[model samples]
Target: MGKDLILQAGRRTITMETAAVAALEARVDDSFHRACELMLGCSGRVIVSGMGKSGHIGRKIAATLASTGTPSFFVHPGEASHGDLGMITRHDVVIAISNSGSSAEVLTLLPLLKRLGIPLISMTGKTDSPLAQSADVNLDIAVETEACPLNLAPTSSTTVTLVMGDALAVALLEARGFTAEDFAFSHPGGALGRQLLLKVADVMHAGEELPQVSPETPLSKALLEMTSKGFGMTTIVDSNGQLLGVFTDGDLRRVIDQKLELDTATMEQVMSRRPKTVSAHTLAAEALRIMEDNKITALVVEDPEHHPIGLLHMHDVLRAGVI
Candidate 1:
């Protein structure tokens, strides 16, 4: 085959898949809506099962549903015939995926599923197939052509089926009013989780680790506290422990330019008044945004009363996976 022919075929495959997905858009009729309703009303998890390529897609759909606030899991239809059907319960809804909708492994479990009164949702390219006819809800995933040049291999058909699954998961996700915070709870080990759920209080250095100085403290003495605290900055507070100003290396450079006596110059005299501050209750992601927008590396964590309770540096949020 010519190289250009291969390239042309590849582009054709992508076009075919796109058209298949477009066809699915119009196929989302009452049957599609009923399938979503069955899943939404299910008291137990939606069990997705299939064989071969359909099985792989089923597993992905199950995972997507689970992560998006819909309770779900995947089961192998072949395994169900061999005693795994015990995992299926009357409270659960079964979603069987097959392009032909008549795989023997799936057909073998039909009677058992019916006996248990489990509602069945069938996703298939053939509405007349056995699985769709037996199902409580049939979602027709028809495709005009296969992306496969030979027209036998599953291609555009599978792509449209997977997209349909995504549509269902997202619809359920919105119907359930799933929030970013709720999604973050399901993914607590990644940066996304930290960004949405982690608070400034969770990452800030408190008490002895916080570098603070009174407004009247000598600039030289405040620098000592800054270096010891290892934050390269110190918050200047009043006698009442309320934040008054902030002192950093930027202030140090200006203080030196003014030829000020370090022993006589107080922190308040050299500090930047009304500097950026964040509440401990704020999300760590918000702190990162503030730092990026302000071009700074550190944030003072204040309490409700505007008192500096802790210090949060860029490294702190980075280490906590907020980066």
Candidate 2:
């Protein structure tokens, strides 16, 4: 193939991948609903099982389920006959995946899977296979053909199975009212988790580390506080600790060019009075957006009544990986 032909073939691969996922949409029926209901009804984890290529897809599906607010784990069927059958329990739900529904190792576990009193959800290309017939709910994951030239590789089958898994997981998620916060709890170190769960209060410098000054504080004194705190800005607050505004190094430079008396000028006279503030409970990523929009580097975290509680700096947001 020519270079252009090769590029067209690569694009065709994505088309095939997308079409494989799209095919599972038509299979969402009462059986799909029953499968979701069965999995949701379980008190223990969803145990995904398969062999060979399906094993790899099953692991990915289990991970998707777990991250999307469902408790799930993948167990290799071959290992189950060897000793891993102990991992299955009466309270657990088993999702057996076999493109042909006749994989020996997967078939080997079904009888014991039934003995455990666990509900079975089967994903297979053939709905009439023994595994599918035995399942409490059968999810059809058939596809048109594989991307492999001879239709021998598991490409299309794997894609449809994954899409079915995602559908089940999302359905369960919605039924349980699982919000972004719930998903974040499961993935505390992931970017999505940080964006949803990390609050200004969690990342802000609070208590003694917060650099602050009063509106009446002299410009020189405010500058000293800002320099010592290393936040590039210090909040100016009133007697009740309500934020009045902010004074920063940039403001000082402008005041100097205007020849304003640093010692005589109060921060209230030189500060940016219309400063932006965020609630301590706001997400850190949201705070980063507010800062980027306002073209400012620091924000004072305020209480519901608008009193300053902490300082959120750009450097801290960067360190937290919000950027």
Candidate 3:
């Protein structure tokens, strides 16, 4: 084939698959609602099963459901007949996927699932097939044609099935009020989890590492502290160690423009009083937002009594992967 023919084939496949996905929006009707209801009301895990290409889609669906707080897992239909059938219980809901709605391996488990009184939901292209007929709710995933030129591949069918699964998972997630924090719990190692779960105290420089100066401290000394800590700023505390103000590299520029004597000027003379601060319990991601909004790079982490306990730097947040 010519290069142009190959490019045309790829574009045609995507166009066909896109149309199939668009058709799904109209098919999210009563059956889709019933399917969501069954899965949402399930007291135990949602068991997803399929055969062949359908099985690949099923695994992805199961993962999306599980991560979205549905509590689901995929079980190969072929394995379920060989003692794995014990995995399904009366409390669970089953999702069976098959484009033809007559996958023999998948159909083999329906009798057992029915005997156990488990709710059955089916995603199939053939509404009249045995699998769809057996399901309590059949989600129609019929596409006009396969993306494959010969109409023999699972292209458009599989895309529609996967998108239908995503629709179901998202609908159930909203029904259950699943939040980002809830999602983070399921994906603790991911970037979203770190952003949601990590707090200022978890990544801030505290105790001896914190750069602090008293209001009476000379400007030269404060600059030394800022340089030593490498935070580009330092907190100015009162006699009782309460945060009184903050001085930063920005202040240094101002002082230079005014030609102020750094050796003689005290922190109280040039420090920004009542500077923006964050509590140690504030989320690192929230701190990043505050930093971006104010166009600043660091924030003073304070205690309940307004005492400076630590310093949160943008670099710290970035290093912790909370961004």
* Clashing residue pairs in candidate 2 (N, C-alpha, C atoms within 3 angstroms): none
lDDT of 3 by residue, 1-323 (tens): 99999999999888989989998999999999999999988999999999999999999999999999999999999888888888888999999999999999999998888888999999999999999999999999999999988899899999999999999999999999999889989988989899888989899989998999998899999999999989999999988989999999999999999999999999999999988899989999999999999999999999999999998889889999876
Off by over 4 Å in 1: none
Among all windows of 10 consecutive residues in model 3, the one with the lowest summed lDDT is 79-88
Q: Is candidate 1 or candidate 3 better by TM-score?
A: 1
Predicted structure 2: lDDT: 0.88
Local accuracy of candidate 2 as per-residue lDDT tens digits, 1-323: 79998988778877997988877788899998898889878899999999988999999999989988778999999889999999988999999999998898999988887887789999999989988998988899888888766789888788888788888888998999998888889988878878888889889998988888988898888889988988888988899888888888788889989999989999889999868889988999999999899888889888888888899998899899776
TM-score per model over all chains: 0.97, 0.91, 0.93
lDDT per residue, candidate 1, 1-323, as tens digits?
A: 99999999889888889888987888778888899999989999999999999999999999999999988999999988888888889999999999998999998888999999999999988999999999998899878778887889999888988999999999999999999988989898877888999999999999999888998899889989989988889998888889998999888998899999999999878999998989988999999999999999999888888899998899989988887
Name the candidate, 1 or 3, with the larger lDDT value: 3
lDDT of 2 at 4: 100
The 10-residue segment with the lowest total lDDT in model 2? 142-151
Error of 3 at 42 (Å): 0.7
Q: Compare candidates 1 and 2 on lDDT and give the better one.
A: 1
- Output the number of the TM-score-best candidate: 1
Residue 129 CA displacement from its true place in model 3, Å:
0.7
